[model samples]
Target chain A: MTKNLSNVNQIIAKYQGDQSALIQMLLEIQRENRWLPKPVLARLSQKLGIPISQIYHIATFYKAFSLIPQGRHTVSVCLGTACHVRGAPRLLDRVTDTLKLNPGETSVDYKFTLKTVNCLGCCALGPVMVVDGEYYGKPSAKEIEKVIANCD
Target chain B: MKKLQKVTLTINDREVTAKEGMTILEAARDAGIYIPTLCYHEKLAPYGACRICTVELSRNGRSRLVTSCVYTVENGLIVKTESPKVIKVRKLLLELMLASSPAKAIQDLARQYGIEKRRFEADKTNCILCGLCVRYCSEIKQANAIGFVGRGTERRVVFHPEIASTVCASCRECFSLCPTGKLPSETDGVCFDDLTLDDFLKTQQSPA
Candidate 1:
């Protein structure tokens, strides 16, 4: 699917073309376009008067930026120490089985992007599975299915 | 121009005088003290990426390890290039580098440190992530055609195909800066759309 992406100029302009706010501009662009296209990076390089290689460096360095297309929903499973002891791996396996998408991979239909995070800083919610921002604690397979089913 | 202030320091029990802002590596090099380095180049800024130049620094009876390439010289500072701690750090760094790059420079360093083999699994990507090519392009050449991408073990050097195709042929300065020689070998790889420097030059030579 093609996104209009005309708003990319507006996003860059919002930051007043400040080189320091490169990450901020990228984040806003990612939020709007779901991914950073090559042409978009080239456009950003031209507009900012910065090198395309430098922009590519920033895009690839941060975990927040996605060079490839991302799905509508972001499903993250915490695999922190606490979550690990609470069967987070098994929970991740269940989610992977349900979505048929491994960590760092998006679904073909653009429904979900499954990811495994080291920690969410919520130790109380061990083995936490978060979809779109809603956190679930040690959810069973059925609960996982119900949550995924509700997304689309 | 204001006269550059000098600082006196002890390196390997030898008194050495250096400019105030000079790094330990520079001071040592000037004083004829040999300290092995990988990611350090005189033309480029002190990156301190490769820890091979790690040295034992002492001040106020306190000693700690620091990369000499970026660490500035100070009055009464004692630097040890081949201390037990520094040797261990260099040895381990050499071993780790040997696993990935095992190139001439790395092998020579490994041999110096008595590292026969690396204990870690060999993942020979050849490119040591030294940033020489990247830094040379950006700092010296100001071309910015190549740069480092990703973080940690996932990090690698990549070329901007658009910029490289335009600037790299006439300016192959970075080709010689690479310590591991990955640049020349990977020039025709997917990054340049399978276009070699010779191919680029040939196309340039051909009439339109």
Candidate 2:
């Protein structure tokens, strides 16, 4: 617990303990820790003099922050307007069947987190599924299986 | 000391003088005019979360609805607190709130406006989300123990267990400020594991 807390102290020090950079500090913490643990948030609230309630408010407000632990690999299926018309739903089904996890849920083994995004800003790559920063446009079920198997 | 500036404006065709920077609601109330409101508290800042205090403001023949709590008074601004346009908006807002909450305060206002039935499908979370309790806890008490979490339809009040467990048992000042009266009764702390308000109270009573 103390080992994890020293990293939190480093992140806070990087910001020079500025109160206005609360959101930025939290995002960095989330990136390193995979989630904002309650103890980390409480420590931030104490050091910054901002209340824990306020920190929790910011944590839950943005879609980027995660209060709970996320998986090692993030699998996001684009459900954008272009993708919707071009078999995004079918693509999502294949991913879910392989992962056995619904959208916004992490796998029981913590291997992958499956979530749907409105857009990945690549309309040309309609029905795109991004797994661990690698994008596949309209990938087959076998390809998805290979992708999941590749991730340790 | 700077002198308080005054401005004159028409409310329901009655010419009234009000202090400069005072809201239209405050001016109307000073003139003994009635404007219904659910989320306006004198102590708290003007949130304008509940649009029940919406009034029609007409200037130079251009009319639009504005929440009286947040809108500051201006010269030559014709304010209508009970116009047909204002009534229609307030009624719809009341209907939306009525569908979500069965609180006595909302029901009483609906009755006053003759809102007999809610047209929308009931998705009652029993929280109108007027944000009174959250704002009061942050602003008045300076103890940001309770606050809102999530966004849009998922948004609801939550009492932070770490802070609330220490500060809330004795200082539940936001309890009386809640219009729904659900804060005290709803023992569930809404989020942050299974920690409830009762648990907080228990922690306080047991002494360390």
Candidate with maximal TM-score: 1
The residue-by-residue lDDT of candidate 2 on A1-152, one tens digit each, is 68668988999899999999999998998878777887898899899999877888788788777777889899989998999999999999899899988887877787788878889888788889999789998899999999989999
lDDT of 1: 0.83
Interface RMSD for every prediction, one decimal? 14.4, 12.4
All DockQ scores: 0.32, 0.44
Label model 1 with its docking quality class.
acceptable
Count of backbone collisions in candidate 2: 0
By summed lDDT, the worst window of 10 consecutive residues in model 2 chain A runs over: A102-111
Off by over 4 Å in 1: A1-3, B189-208
Q: Tell me the lDDT of model 2 at B37.
A: 85
In model 2, the runs with Cα more than 4 Å from the true position are B188-208
- In Å, residue B89's CA in model 2 sits off its true spot by 1.3
What does the i-RMS of model 2 come to? 12.4
Score candidate 1 by DockQ: 0.32
Shift of residue A17 alpha carbon in model 1, Å: 1.0
- C-alpha lDDT of residue A24 in model 2: 93
| Worst ten in a row by lDDT for model 2 chain B | B199-208
